[model samples]
Target chain A: MSSKIRIEDARRFRVGDGFRLSDVDPTATPGFSGSDKDLKKELVQHDEEIGVLQEKLHAEKQNSLLIIAQGMDTSGKGGLIKRLLDPMSPLGYRVQPFGRPTEEEAAHDFLWRVERALPKPGEVVCFDRSHYEDVLVQKVDALAPAEEIERRYGAIVEFEQQLAERNIMLIKVMLHISKDFQKENLRDRLQNPEKLWKFDPSDLNARAEWDEYMDAYQIALERTSTETAPWYCIPGDNKDYARAVVKHLVVDALRTIDPQYPTPDFDPKAELATLESMD
Target chain B: MSSKIRIEDARRFRVGDGFRLSDVDPTATPGFSGSDKDLKKELVQHDEEIGVLQEKLHAEKQNSLLIIAQGMDTSGKGGLIKRLLDPMSPLGYRVQPFGRPTEEEAAHDFLWRVERALPKPGEVVCFDRSHYEDVLVQKVDALAPAEEIERRYGAIVEFEQQLAERNIMLIKVMLHISKDFQKENLRDRLQNPEKLWKFDPSDLNARAEWDEYMDAYQIALERTSTETAPWYCIPGDNKDYARAVVKHLVVDALRTIDPQYPTPDFDPKAELATLESMD
Candidate 1:
């Protein structure tokens, strides 16, 4: 059987002023196949080019990136962080994994801790969970005053703007895993001994409040997606595909940044080969 | 053919103290084979219980670490950084690959920039080359005042003491390759086309003043090696062996600091299994 696919067909993504996060299909499969096998095949195809691109960025050492992976628990943050950073040189990159803020941090502005964690020029910083935690968790749990929650969002955008102004590129990835995926993920962790350390009982309470969290995320995306930094909603049900999408975004952004070597006065290739003879 | 090796025999190193930087035998094959290999192996091998130790320390997340590497033009800073970090999770790690200091950085005290790169609780920060730059490069080129040069070493030790007080463990490495190996490396860069970008013509000019630079490095290491953050003089001609040695040093230090997971309030495995079934 043969079928015609329109150029404008399902691949098009719209984020209207009035669009709600729920209105967006959290589980909507965009491509021909939703299978993880298809994603592995597609992702592996770009491996060589992507590897070259990574080397180019490392060599150029121009732009510093702070990759914010913000999703609820079980959103594939850990897995995504591993895959994207695995191929690249760890020398110029870093990751900040935040849990609850310290008392000293809470006493100060939310961004203070993050400011300390930001990568210098020519470095890349990955935030497994970042400042957004204040807004997301605080809003859903009613842990803070309503005014305080509202203020944090504006504070986040302002902080991000300052980073952009300073030539730091920020990538905000919302690992959009559906409730179904979360349930299955939680189940897998239960049966597996190795994954025992990952299971948290309170996750059930979070799932109970899933709809409320969704509404909160909707507003979070709507308010925060700015011109300098746009939110890339990654369909994360299939873990491998989510990884591929994030890696695509990372390499594409690096390509845009285009890292280049600092023109050392001598030929490096010849220099490297000198060791070949010593063998 | 088997003979008993004594403890002192095993712990003994080839080159003694007071050797110049280029005096290091980069081409000397490390004990990678034979009885001598087994004799010296224990000195190189720290406790292999590193993983178990790290897991315990992962819980308290108490002490942080910073590994700083500094040396001349062909010194093995980049390679050192890679081997140290290759085994660990990139999640709680940061690397600062400093080039020329920014004017803003130069305006501040030399330690300010380096201080800013310190890792937080339970994280590790590796500097491919660090603040010792002002002393090393400046001394070699007569770029800084002798008074200023002398003062910073004491200040650097104090800076490291502060880090140690704050529970930041520091490990410094100076990869010592002999003048012979460096000459071979420089020639390789000049002769190969692929290494064109890395070739710096004046590397030979710098190599010409080899002894002067070695004296500078010797002074830097002597002044800065302290109880809290001692320096390791790694004989680095054998690239693979150097990588292996640095890898084990990191493992050794990290194991001693150790890491442990925080006790979960709920069984993560059970939670994960439940989540997996939600679909």
Candidate 2:
């Protein structure tokens, strides 16, 4: 696939003004124009580039990258994190998994815990299920009142704007998986003993509320995907294709950031001589 | 103050085997060998060095630094953080304040919230109060059973060791203040309308159990001040002196780490030529 065309096609998946979730097909691989083997080769190249860029970002120490992964239970957030970050230095990246909020987190504004989890300068942080849960799960289950949920969308946009202003490059991705795809994933988890640990009965309840969850995600994506921090709805039925697309998106952002190794403050020639003398 | 001697004197306050909190004179300024003006000047220098070194650390991005501040309610934890981090870039630093844990945090191990608050690589994080509180306040108030508190000390040692193994420079400081000094601070808070918000009724209750709290601290410092994360007891009665001492300690750690700006991977000359051509 021509990377230029692939990037443009991927951009089409980005939520923008008047976008609709129904317009996206979970099984469609818009960006991958190649066979599976060729796609794998492309992913490897992206991974190598990401690794180098991450080091430069670390050296630059002026900005941070935050990737927020949100999706249904079987949509592969964990798998994506493992694959994307595996080639990078552990020191420069972290994965923060947002599970059930502890009582203390619930006491404050929903954004409080998320603010605490943001990346420091020169770091890349991924949130596996992020603050979007406040709008998604809360809205579907009616865990929060309607007005409060409405307020959250506004809060998220403002919060994301502030993050961008603070030099945090925020990428929001929703793993778009069909109901049938999710059912297959759930069945696989149940049938395979090794994968059974991943299964949760509560996931079935979420599945029952599938349409409600999708509506919640649709509204959230439409309202909060601003010029800064756009949301990309990745086709999750083809896990390998989805992973490659996400990798491309992340690499594209890194290329745009284009962090360079900072100039040395001290004289390296003199420092090297001093080091040799010490030996 | 002679910063070299002050750093040494501060070392004397670090909790080691057989250390006792009662033996520390909270009113003493053991290392300030100069007048107030000289001490102020030294602190300013330390601040400048800290700011520069922090930048280098951020550029290097191989390790992180975590500073934990623990003390009585009015013992100047907030003031110290503001003074220490004020000269540094906000992008590389974060401050996490631990109050009463919410119901969710309470359900997990005491270290769960703390682990969540740890710094990312190339970052400096300060905790206003940390896991020590689980043993300090919890033990003094019988908030947790004796056995649980006992388990926590061992857990803390192992946790700190793991952090050290992961290239996290852990510095724990206890702002030691006399009961009389605390009383004066509390009285000042009550009298000054501007400071009234800082006062909590709980402070009085804590004051009532002063001796018990000291005993708790004495035991805690003895049990958990491992070589990996030693505890420094900074006299808190004189805020300026305390701030300078903390500054020196932090600067010393940065010097030991000696982070340097990384070498460029690409040819800067060629890149500059390309950019010049574009312009």
Indicate which candidate wins on lDDT: 2
TM-score on alpha carbons, each prediction: 0.75, 0.54
State the lDDT of candidate 1 residue by residue for B5-116, as single tens digits: 3323212222245544454555553444435455345323443454344434444568777888766666677766665565556765677877778999989998888878
lDDT of 2 by residue, A1-279 (tens): 433226776677788888889988999877566677777776666777898788778767788899999999889887777667755655567678798899999999999999998998989998989999999999999999999999999999999999989989988889999988887787676555445545656777788788899999999999999999899998899887777778878888899889876655544444333333331
Clashes of each: 49, 3
Q: Quote model 2's TM-score.
A: 0.54
Q: Write the per-residue lDDT of candidate 2 for residues B8-67, one digit (tens) a residue.
A: 876777888778787888888886776777777766777777877887777677888999
- Fraction of true interface contacts that also occur in model 1: 0.57
RMSD from true fold, candidate 2 = 19.1
**Candidate 2, fnat value?**
0.00
Give the alpha carbon lDDT tens digit for every residue of A1-279 in model 1.
222222232223323366566655656555435455666665555557655555555555666777999887888897788777876778667777888888999898878898988977777778988888788887899878989989987887788888888878988888888887787677776665545456667778888888888888888888887778777766667677667666666766776777665566544555445334442
Chain A: TM-score in each candidate?
Answer: 0.85, 0.96
lDDT score, candidate 2, position A175: 91
lDDT of each: 0.69, 0.81
Give the runs in model 1 whose Cα sits over 4 Å from its true position.
Answer: A1-20, A23-45, A61-66, A98-121, A142-170, A180-205, A226-228, A258-279, B1-23, B33-59, B99-112, B142-167, B183-205, B222-229, B264-279
